[model samples]
Target: MNRFRPVRTMVAAGTVLAAAGTAHSAWNSTALRTPPPDPPPVTEYVSLLMPVRNEAGRVGPALRSLLAQEHLPRAEVIVLDDQSTDDTGDVVRRLCGPYRHARVVRGTAPKPGSPGKAHACHQLASLARGSVLVFVDADVVLASHAVASSVALLRSTGLDLVSPFPRQAAEGPANRLVQPLLQWSWLTALPLRRAEASPRPALSAANGQFLVVDATALYGCGGFAAVTDEVLEDMALIRALKRAGGQGGIVDGSRIARCRMYDGWRDLREGYGKSLWTAFGSGGGAAAVCALLVWAYVVPPLAALRGSRWGAAGYVAAVTGRTLTARRTGGRCWPDALAHPVSVGLLVALTARSWLGHRRSTLTWKGRPLRGWH
Candidate 1:
């Protein structure tokens, strides 16, 4: 037994490496799905609803793109200024003045238990007049055919809701390093086809940056009002839609829509830190996720650097997965794929910050203190 110790060690290492490689392959194969095909003929009226607060500078280009939509003839654009302290309301009015169907709504203060953005979205949904509602973030710039393509996908697929995640336009170092992981996270973790078919909310994922939903289906799920206090309203809404027996899925909309979600490192940090705690369901879930991330992303690289051949293979597979996702989503590949360990480290830090803030009741966004998790 003493003489066979080396053999046992080798076997253990081999088993770990094999498991890692299998997991990597599973993730890589599912990383970048074929994007949905182009739009078929759809003449339905589409309403573009955006909720904004202190986004005076960013909202203009998004509005311009919405107004310039070519395929949808009877489209209307609605912008809800969620009690902005800046020139957001004025800017929206001035920019929308030229389009007859475009209008801006002044949002009232959120109720006692409601989250700000969710409340604003609810108001916009209440006022929407189209059968199809396309919720666009203030910073998202849509291609001329984006609305038509998205609506066509929803109609063609028979899904009640669809989040056409846009291509993230990362600027600063922090943005470039971290934002790509957004696309990669769901792309690798959740199998899109299975999520589309399953009604389990746990499997549901969505990006609120550019989401499309059937107005009636949204109403059937209690609308944004149902998720009024949810910090991750996108995920909450998707789960609600799924629980209501409605089907929806995410599609690669990198070619059709683009967004610069954060201006710099600080912006990116706070933006993510606000909701990271609740993102994983509970504290235990968050811990499990952290452990998995560290094991999957960090351990292999460290082991490789320490002279483990199996770790080297795992590292290669991990980088390959990141490269695949980046190429498909237009995210940076070179340094990011190589920097996976660093990215995981930063994410772990962010998660810790988020959890600490949640415990201390100090997590806030855009000047409002975040309410405790449900």
Candidate 2:
């Protein structure tokens, strides 16, 4: 019974442990919100660009949202179509045909072994006319003043790069657990406000979904050329910007941008699969850490239920802590919290598969293989 006690207790402990983890995470949850403060007004030209690859359904709404924005009515929008099999090119053409500032340009894949996004963005940057260059993923939708608000921040702070933390729209059972968990993890890892308050070049939070870069500084800092091979382009870009004596931070995209990320769980899985392993880096060490994290929450609850009240209590404490932390970070619906165990499991499995795919360089996104994943 004693041997089995810990096992049983682990089950009970999982809940408590998760709670505790959430609690610790709450302290750093401000990364999700855009503080009410606005950047001082300054004269800065901005151009918005979107690089699309077979994003027909989502592109229209995304573009429409931008056209409707009250800020930067003159901000030119350029969509770089990346050889899509779908009517992505047609959609971009039709959606913005009436707007003179809105334009669509075609993009080609980089030569074998060269990174695709950096290459494409390099081309887009060349044609871009704004003093401030912005890259919004095709899936990203902008708020009426998102461009205005963001540019204001950059000008006011004199920062080199700006990225928004998006408010994701997720549906179905699978999205409920995994997406929120993923966001929570981000909230836990980076404390943006504190980073901004410090002087030692801390706090690295970004979402490629809505990345804004200063055109001149980008060139001065070696541009995307510096991070040509990085799988996590957003983070790499931010790091490069900082290394080049620039500042990077996240802003409230709620007023500036919105992203659904994927149409379904499979889409989410494949998308994350292509980049997750790379996000954590080579070897299977990332897998080990992920598994351990999931088990940390899963085990405690089981133990608590089995009779080792102490273990069970500890786990419950942990889980409660995690829950509180999540609420502070940005609340997910209650059902997602209930389904966290399964969500965590799916994430681990997906991450493991991603790592395998990365090792073999077999990961693909939107029908394009991510070259040099390993």
Candidate 3:
């Protein structure tokens, strides 16, 4: 009887987490709200910044979306081809030629100890002349009102910066298992209301794909230069801004922007492996999170297959939580939710690989080594 004690304990813990995750998902659904419609004829001018590298075939839709903005005259688009080996520069130049305000600039190499993306962003800021600076990733497609609404949200709330985390579009096997977990991690764990209200750096969240900030505030916090070495530059910038006494927080932008972050299994794996270990702060924190996930998400399904009724209920609750999160974030949930354990397992594996790669100096992205991944 004592030999089964650990299994019984795991079953009980799984039940508790499933209940908590379900409740947390429910709370997030109620708390997350869409940004208000953009005021007509938005007077505030915005510099839309793009940093690209080897995005030849995939960046066209994003460029098209930016050029077709309904609030165009108030927006100036700037593209920095960060020393691409492909035709990314040509794609940008050809697509943006008709827009009088659009300009493409050649990006220089990063200074020592600085991440390439952060350096590219800092260079873009030097060329921008707008009061509002919008940093957009090359893979994101913004809605017609995305810029206008983001600016309006900032103006109305009196915040210095706002990160409108776009809806993640995941396809293929790996993506279907892993992408939805991005939004779920914060939505269920961070308590959005508190994060929004708190100015603490640890509570802040930001997505690089669609970050909107007041130009003055960004410069005030030293722009991306403040987080030059950070692998997660987006979230680091938010933290730096908050520590600099500027108020900023995340908002639900599922209605305004969509991003397909990686192409397939290999891309997705390395994409995550480049930063997952550092995401939770330290080795200890990463270990704790991984253990928790294994217990909360992975174990129940295994026990269920072994004919444990309570474990089956826990699996149902976990799936319900994922479904609720997907409903809110505009992701696929049906089959993916059923594979929640698989997703968590993949995340754990990626995180372990990330730490190992960092130790071995093998972690890289777009030909740049992630030196600060430790």
Go through the candidates in order and give the clash count of each. Answer: 0, 45, 0
Residue 207, model 1: Cα distance from true site in angstroms: 0.9
lDDT of 1 by residue, 1-374 (tens): 69955644553454364355446435644543333456654588888999999998888899788888877878789999998999999999998999899999999898653448999999999999999999999999999888888888788778898888899999877887788888878766777778875888778888888999999999999999999889999999999988898988788789899999999988988998899998898999999888777776777677777776656766777787677778877778887788877887788888988898888877778777776554
Regions of candidate 1 where Cα sits further than 4 Å from its true position: 1-41, 112-114
* Ranking, lDDT, top scorer first: 3, 1, 2
Cα-based lDDT at residue 30, candidate 3: 89
Residues 1-374, candidate 3: write the lDDT tens digits: 99998887889798789779889878977876567766455687889999999999899999888877776467799999998998999999999999898999999998654448988998999999999999999999989888888888888888888888899999888888999999888777777766765777668888889889999989998899887788888988988887778887778889889999999999998888888867988999999989988888888888999988878888888888888888888888787898988888989999999889888877878877766444
lDDT for every model? 0.82, 0.69, 0.86
Ranking by TM-score: 3, 1, 2
lDDT of 2 by residue, 1-374 (tens): 68965665555455555555565566555444452334443356678888888888878888887766554644788888987899999998999899888888999777675447877777788888889998888777777667777777766677777776666777766666677665566555556665543334335656778887789888887777677687677777776676777777676565456678877878888888877786654455676668566766555545555666655565555545446544653446564565555666777888888887876888777676777644
The residue ranges of model 2 lying beyond 4 angstroms of the native Cα positions read 1-20, 30-42, 113-115, 194-203, 308-331
Candidate 3 is scored at a TM of 0.95
1 or 2, greater by lDDT:
1
Candidate 3 RMSD to the correct structure: 1.6
In terms of lDDT, the best-performing candidate is 3
